[model samples]
Target: MSAFPKRDFRASMTWLHSWAGIIPTLLFFAVFWMGTLSVFDKEIDRWMQPESRYAGPPIAYDLDASIETFIGAQNGVEVTSLFIMPPKPREPYLYFYGVLAEEVNGKTYSYGRFVGESNEMLGEPQSLAGSGFIFPFHFKLHIPGNFGYYLIGAVALAMLVLTVTGVIAHRKIIADFFTFRPTRKARRVTLDLHNLMGVVGLPFYFLFALSGLYIFAGWFAALPMQTVDGVMGKSPVAFLELADSQSPKRRPRAGQSIAMDKAIMPFKTQAEALWSERYGAPVMADRVRIEHYGDANATVIVHRVFPGRRVTMAQDRIDFDYATGTVLYDQQATPATATRSWLEGLHFVQFEHWPLRWLFFAGGAAGCILTATGALFWMRSREKKAGAQPFNIRFVHAMTVGSVTGIMLATGVFFVANRFIALGALPPGIAPIEWEPITFYIAWLLSFIHAAARGRSAWMDQCFFIAILSLSAAVLNWVTTGDHLIKTMTTGMWSIAGMDLLLLLTSALSAWSAIHLRGKARQRPFAVQGDDPALQPAE
Candidate 1:
């Protein structure tokens, strides 16, 4: 029996899958890769920060002294609040980040998310304090927020639809369940792997699609209700109230700079006691904030990131009155908040032990492989279906290769550019754009041009380029940062050096694939006669 159940079912579903995947395949590849990278976003930040390798534990510091040093280093700087990062996977550096108000070119400016030593800022400013390209690349290709979210949501919904129709089209679902006939050429090979991987990972794909949509669900699904509520004039206040419910309230004017360290002591004591009794654990304190400086009723808030069952990675905000040093609010979260907390923890891998984080990392790599294979499958299928339509076939083929491999190549180059650009080795006038889309665009555009020119040879050529460039970037990082693989591993500086070793491993894989593709392309071509029953496999 056909999996499609009816003639129209097969026709309609085939139509849906083909068209849905065609329009967004390129964009989808980028989204999948970038979003995966956001998992280790902070590690990328640590890798880019050369000094972090030598910095101490992220939490073992006095907040008052750290803030004092940071503020004193920048003359006339006012501190709004500070975000303290806990010790990462293998990095010991405690990072203190804050915003600074400054006047640049006669215009008032606010600089955000700056990293510093106890109080000393770095000599040269780095782009967005090591956020790299992952965060913005996830939703937008650095596009405007409004347009980007809607576009991404649409793509995700299309993917959901594609997954459903795809399952319906694969008739030999269980018979070919574990079969991957890589020996077959082009379409058969591509189709087999595509269907196999897509069907096997179908559940995960659907979960990710659904979760991603829920992250932006309000935009598309609840539009009319949102509009109606907005028109009623209660939405703004409701939104603010929701935000306030989560955020710590601002302290009133205390009329003096009361000792923040003293104010936080009470909350810290209470929190430590609570954690020891309820969770039977030790807590790591990150930072404490004193809001509304010089105000009479100013409050102090202490934030800690600790390991616990309820909120495996929890941020407990303990508020205290600045003048009285009295505990104002304990702010313990509910069971539902813990569920949200766990989702966040799982998303970032923030509270994971080493084994779990590595497991998550492996899963992320699988996703990347899945994306690259899907693109390759598209190319091979088009070659079989498109005989006389050579130009259209080549166009899609080039795009598939260009976008998939191009992203990998560009990521390597971006890391290389980070080191070289800092030393003024690149050309002048290459300052990063406000949103930094141009760099990725230029790299991707060059890949398109190269792929279009090279035709069938593009895949092997790009793979070889990626292998060389990736290794080259790793070498360059070692030269500049002195945080190469050997030293980093030996010194327990895993984040920076570990990333380098991973790149080297990736390079090796790319090199092997390139060699394989190059050899395969040299084989003789075959064109099957449609009318020859003998040429067709036994049905």
Candidate 2:
């Protein structure tokens, strides 16, 4: 029975799915590409920050040495509630991050980096390649303020809508899963690929969208309260205190300072001991957070996660009164909180699992394929009508080219810029780390302009650019860093090697696509497409 008998509900669903997916297809592709890159964010960081790829032995977990190093390296810039990250298998850099006692250049937090083992300060990082750039771009799109969150939230919501409407519009969802016609016409072939990917990767699409929404719920929930807090003249975090009653609250400083000689770093060892005994495993420490540092009310929280053992990143920790050896809070996740953690863990994949990481990479790639193919199918279906509505079809075609291949081209530029941009040659005002993303955004904008100018030929031109950029980035990585495939492979630095391999693979694929598109253009010399078929069954 039709849900609305007056209107063909399935036809309405088909229309809804087409327009809804079409509207944000480019944005969806951007998010999918960034999210995929973020899967190995740390590995990319290692590759970009060549200084971090230390050849020396791993640092013996000396909490005291880390403390001494942190203090002397600060150079009198007051920092509070310090968070110290030690060397791990994936992340080799010893990172000292904390809130500045007083804001500088409109920034509240300051970060200090050092080689993972040696205490020599490396100063500012070469670039914010991974954790600082690509990872954040996935959720935020680098849009300023809460607007990015709101916009991404709306896009995620649209994804859920598109997924449902697509399923409802499909007359035979089951058969579509097993059907993809490579030998068919371009219009039919893209539709088949779109259906095949959408069916196969549906769960990943749904869950990623849902989980991303959940992960940002608190920020969304904070909007109304932020307005109220603004009116009431309270600190922004005042909402968190009211909402988060589960964890211990931040204490006010008692104003009494401790001597520099006082060493409370041993608490990490004690906390690990208590946690290992409670959890029935030998758990090592990941990082330690010293809250209210140098004050009488100081406290220390040591954190760890059982990466290979559990998928739930529960953040098993023991909080201590830093002045004394007293366990203040030994945390155990509540049932409700554990449920939330499992959902978040599924989305973030913070734990170390190679196979699961690759699975997520595949899922993200599948999203990109489905979205791109769906958009292409729409363009193909509209070709016969192009003569009547030239502007609309042409406009969307330009968008399709820019958003699909343009983002890929821009990312290649980002990688290449990291290697080639000389620190000293940069304009007087621009910092090295800040310059790379600037190059990325500029490259991306130029892509849209090129697409608008070149029309349908833009697709072939951009693919060629994509291939050359990918190949250039790989060559630059070797030329600048001297870490080619053979060097990195023999040295057991698989992460760097993996990045090179991915770039080469992208080059191969884009070159093939460029060649294929070029051949099609030659055969037609005009239309490049034989027919304008309506969306139809493959088999």
Candidate 3:
């Protein structure tokens, strides 16, 4: 039945699967795991900052008043950006960004977190309310702008290709779907896991890759189209011009300011009315953007859309004059923009409810497991032949342990560092925001080196490391936040205490695997592949 000298389809796939699975394992591991935790990104911020506890009336002060007071408080301060918050369940803090000082003429005071009404610091100054570092590293590792994005794009493309090739090469899709022949040598065991996870998580894996790639499509895939539009007949500028042409261009006077008291509710209602008129049906308003602060002619733009629609498809761009608060420009989405809007919406998961978010999180975790198991299969399949190729095997092994076990440890370390730095246990001069990356990288590097030197024993070493890191993360939270497992359960502070329980689970699994592995080592080599004389070396 086969055309090649590899004989059986299974044998041919053995060769193809090794390379396909191994090549992108580490990159995908980083992507998937980070994405999993990113689902709870906001929760991580809440857990880190203990002082944000409040059901107090939402701060409804005048926008202009807050801006002027904050500006006056800091001489030579410039507000680069500001983010206003809606009445969300987790964090109701209105965020402000600008240069400021803790002391007059002091070394550019870096309290970026303590922002609110009249520049009156809302929460504790030393709290870790903004864990901005962890979320970004999950994608491109924050390598200056588009570079990280391109790298992720490359990996996503590889995932697409690998999935396609893997499906074609496998002949027993249905049979392998439920199979896990762990006793049939190391190679069989590895192959089983790779097939099982890959098959089971195929839909999720494809969506993640495709969606992730779409997010960067503008940078990589759509660049040529953008370039063509820019160069040909002034077409590129049409979209931006379209948005700007229909939107308000009114600039407010420099000195005058007006109160935006209860501005949000009315703005939302009116914007909805305008959209309903345009679209021939009602739509809900999502976000409000206030522009040109400290001016009489300032405008507010309200975004209205269907509740489950993508961000791009919103009947967006409604403007109102600040002084008279009269509607100026109201634009609705055309049928042509609907597809782009829907794709953009699908990519962002903007319409996700809490249940949907958790489901997304579960999908992300399954992707992580799928990637990890794929890497493990690559290593185990080559265990015997790789004996002569120690460094190559070691490198793969290191990546396997480092990315799989090491990242878990690194994440634990990150939370631990957050607790220490947030509680003021870490010394001064150490920038709190920068500490998360430093600790995570340090943990990753240490695990990589440890995995290389220790060989198969690195698994044990990493298991122990993970066990320690997970338990320590929980313990640190208890010590710093005064919230333990029982208290967290009773009071519903699951974010902080649930993180600890996860660590305990990780520890238990690692401990059990380590003991089993140690016992199995005496019978034969811990992981040995079949010795087939005809099996050719990797090309």
Candidate 4:
């Protein structure tokens, strides 16, 4: 129980906790904040894309038809492979992809949307939408070249350090779990919330951080496999193929090209009969993949499971030899890999459990609050030294304002812009859908500038702006789509209705916080989480 002198250990831990908590606070907030929003990413996709909100009878897709369409009219491009995502809730369109022959385009992929059972292709994506923009930003921060992976990995590591040191730094976590002081002075109230969020969210914080680290640094754990590959002088992809049996296995294209109908012959009936027996029931193919397009030896794979019925990221799939319909491999995760998949699934929240999804949202929001308050509390606690370091205090406050309220403001604007810009009125050269992200970044950059210029007053101002944007976006959705809350609620479109309800709640909360801050400012200007000498605690 006792490894080192308790007092000294606690002292060191407290010191570490304070700095570690603040150093990566901005990136940490961004990750959790975006990740929380990503919980409803597909729902948000429906909100952002009107075509995606189509409410029609369920439709089926034909792989042979899709393959025929791809190979027939792509002009000089020889299709090597295909991926098809069938219509699903909030995503009621068939998405089809074609991988070009290696010599044809050096292994490039092109994709389009198909509205119904017909094999006709709809042109490029209408918008980035939530799944494309918000979800990727959660893990990548929009950074390229795997740098984002490493950066996020580092932040997760810091969170683990902060979590451990916080446990050791303070001994009254149980008390703090039940403690929050709303009526006290701003500093005391902030500190109580900081402790309370830390206590109540300890498990959530630890598990998410741990899982996120493992996901990004999983390659680090594969060092042994990498070493084995290096020793064997094998392409690293072979290790991946061994690890994931359902992943596409490549066979060199034998110059003997075949017709599209012949290449897709094995998938239409024989494959379905096989999978139906394998699962002990009829199976609906979720997506299909192929390799060595139009070649006699091409491999075809079908993924059948969706993420709704299980907590794990469903990867149930079977591979087939193209011409013969003979089963090549069926995915079966080993115990170790299954555990890893669960850890990843837990962090990603891809499952369809509503209660757990909301809890994850709550935990992520709590983390945001914890990091924000912890930073503010540290600043207030060091008020004496703050005079000697005005620039640093101001810098920290600016970062907090920009990272917290600023990002929320930007997202609200993004949603609002999606409705306002639907009429396709962008100036020459810029596409209509392209303006969505352009507006988002412009709004975000301006938020940081506003925070820097307004100093301590920016928080309340931006809170009011967030409220305005949220309310505006919700109302505009009604104005444009005629899918008001009542209509969606009655029509059984709970996903859209739920998102609308959340928008209203966001507006209400932001407005209340702004009004509260204004009232406190009238009582003592710059009162809550601000530097005011008259409000300082008597030591």
Per-residue CA lDDT of candidate 3, range 372-402, in tens?
Answer: 7777766765666566887788788988888
lDDT pick, better of 1 and 4: 4
Clashing pairs in 4: none
Clash pairs for candidate 3: 252-297, 310-345
lDDT of 4 by residue, 53-156 (tens): 75556766665676566556677777766666667655777776665554433325566676666667676566777887888788868774456767888888
> lDDT of all the models against the reference?
0.61, 0.77, 0.63, 0.74
Total clashes in model 3, counting residue pairs 3 or more apart in sequence or in different chains: 2
Cα lDDT of candidate 2 equals 0.77
Candidate 1, pairs of clashing residues? 58-94, 69-119, 70-119, 253-295, 253-296, 254-295, 254-296, 255-294, 255-295, 255-296
The prediction achieving the highest lDDT against the true structure is: 2
List ranges where model 4 is wrong by over 4 Å.
1-7, 70-73, 102-107, 116-120, 219-248, 262-285, 304-307, 527-539
Ranking by lDDT: 2, 4, 3, 1
Error of 4 at 200 (Å): 1.9
lDDT of 1 at 370: 59
lDDT of 1 by residue, 1-539 (tens): 65344546766676566666766777788777776676666667677656554533443434455445555655665554444443433444444444334443332322222233344444323533235457667765656325666788887797788778878766677888898888765556666767676766777667567657764663344344444334322221233223333454654454555444443445556656765676567664555555554346665666665553332457566777766767787766677666555554565455546666666566555555656666665554555555878888778878888778888777766776667654556566666422234555677788989999988788888899889988987888888876777788877666776678877988999999899988877773333223322112111
Give all TM-scores, in the order shown.
0.82, 0.91, 0.79, 0.86
Model 3 weakest 10-residue run by lDDT: 107-116
Better of 3 and 4 by lDDT: 4
Q: Report clash pairs, candidate 2.
A: none
